[model samples]
Target: MSVTKKVILITGGSSGIGKAVGIYLSQKGYIVYGTTRNVANYSNFIHFPLLTLDVTKTDTIKKAVNDLIAKEGRIDVLVNNAGVGITGPVEEIPDNEICNHFETNYFGAIKVMKGVLPQMRKQKTGLIINVTSIAGYMGLPFRGVYSASKAALEVTTEAIRMEVMSFGIKVANLAPGDFATNIAGGRYHAPVIEGSDYQKNYQMSLDLMDAHVDDGGDPKEVGIIIEKIIQTPNPRIHYKVGAFMQKFSVFLKRILPDKTYEKLLLNHYKL
Candidate 1:
């Protein structure tokens, strides 16, 4: 590994914010590798190497991390960005789908961290940036499952950061707002079944969510923030990048009463 250029591994880098960040880092001369479940689909990918990784599977996670270590000799940074989205009323969402959302967004990120920590410990210095969401700050209407999954990672990141501090490993969560990504298309949504109690409200929230993503900011800005965070000698445990109202909503939650916040959210979603 080149002393001046760090090796970065970003999971779920095939598209969206992950791809944006990976490409930005690679363009600036960092040695970068992005991961996707199916590599054959990206045979001609030119931005940086896209390795085979399926965060849902432990075997694939180990292989990707080990192979990168073998080739690079050290893994300096890991952006645990692989995750899926689920939308619908919490009660209406199927149990399996809720489990699957956590499987990839929560457990999968943990597995990847487990795979890389050994090498980072050996090096005595490394950084892991877990990509969470601004939504994780609060329970959003129709996005409850996705919110919970990211929130789980957020709290876990806080706990693990302390556990590994003595080893010289720094962990942080990057919570991004909508970023004009393909997440909406890939997101799982419970059918808007007619006459169901949640049918009308769920549809309203779903449409609002789609519009937010469609009007999201450039994802490369997140890459820029990642670069800054990597440069900081000691990075904070939490970082958020998004529109003013989106970030402000977090502040509101802290100061307002519980029901007050709930009312505000209900109003925003027009429920």
Candidate 2:
């Protein structure tokens, strides 16, 4: 019997890492369906079909998944790549803004997962790759909210991996560090009050964040990693992709003393 080509669904595919993955996977012969909030605007730009999806909206998430399944009959892989970043001092960050960050970065992913799980459960085979960040592992100085949001997703991904293993559904967290993308343009800056204690430090940290992204690793590298993961029958649970120093930081966080790790992080960020 000939193996059927897998149907893959990727969220936030209008640009950045998600767009690269969609283009690469579609070129590799898989039926790739990418989701974007403004499909009308992005439809002409992307190579593959673009589904209208706003991850924070449950109705849109459902419609996007249903539309893909109605046409393709199955969604073999789901990449939860949709997320937003919020930056500033934790104390000054508004509650609603923090909620918004979680809504898009964490809860939005959960909504998409719920939308696709039933079909994968019925088919008894599937793969879920959550595109998280190295910041998820360690909270950055100004990007605390963004880090916390990804960290929440990382923990949730672990739980889902165990829960779905019995149903032949494999789950993995893809942690990337500082990729060249338009993420800075989309990031929300917390309101900084005049004379606030964290003003100078926050500005310095924010500038460093932007510089890291500007000089970051190529996002195509991440796309290549996603393609490989899609082809693997039994993939590992966690994959960290990025520069050697970033990957090593994760390892160091695990082994170093709390104070020692804090010093290392401080030195790296020039804090």
Candidate 3:
């Protein structure tokens, strides 16, 4: 592949936002490498080269990073986008599911950073963009697990920005609102058990969640925002991308009274 202004590594790049980012950046002339859990599965389908990297597995992370650096000499950007979606009433969600959710969405992202930060530090310049979500800004009704996991990443990125600034590495969190992607199909939804207190509300949320994704904006919009962030000289600590109301929800939570905001959420979810 021909080189460009930057070499970007995007995890979970095989599909959804990750795939969109790879395609957009590659078209814009950036050398882009996307990672998937299994490269063989996407060999015939992907537009760009994909590396085998499972964020939950340290060995795979190390191999993917090493292989990239060995080929590209240095990595100028790392987009920690590999993550899975989980949604359910916090009370009913199984412990294993929660653990697995954090394993991929939160811990997996951190490990990916650990794999690439060393190379970035050596180069003395790099950008790490952690893809979070607008839902992270508030505790959504039944999406408690999903909100918490993304929120964790957002908070961690804030601290990481400070710690790595001296090393000339910039860390930022890009929280996208609902985007049209295959994420709905892959999400972990805790069983809507009969006779449970949350049965009705949980089912309503699950349906709403899927509907939102189906009606969400194009995934490439995220790539557009990411490209802008890459072009920026000193990118901000946090960025949001999505529809008017979805992003506005975040701002609303900040300015509105606590109970007022809770009421607004309750009304939206039809609880």
Would you estimate the TM-scores of all the predictions? 0.98, 0.96, 0.98
Tens-digit per-residue lDDT, 24-142, candidate 2: 88777888888999888864684889999999999998899889989989999999998887898989988999888888999999999999999999999999999999989998788
Where's the lowest-lDDT run of ten residues in candidate 1?
1-10
Ranking by lDDT: 1, 3, 2
Cα lDDT tens digits, model 3, 1-271, are 2336689999999999999999999999998999999988875865788999999999999999999998989999999998988878888889999999999999999999999999999999999999999988999888888899999999999999999999999999999999999999998888899999999988997898899999999999999999999988899999999999998988889999999999998888999
* Model 1: CA > 4 A from native: 1-4
Q: Which stretches of candidate 3 lie over 4 Å from their true place?
A: 1-3
Q: Is candidate 1 or candidate 3 better by lDDT?
A: 1
Residue 103 of model 1 has an lDDT of: 92
Could you give candidate 1's per-residue lDDT for residues 152-175 as a string of tens digits? 999999999999999999999999
Q: Which regions of candidate 2 deviate over 4 angstroms?
A: 1-4
Candidate 1 TM-score to native: 0.98
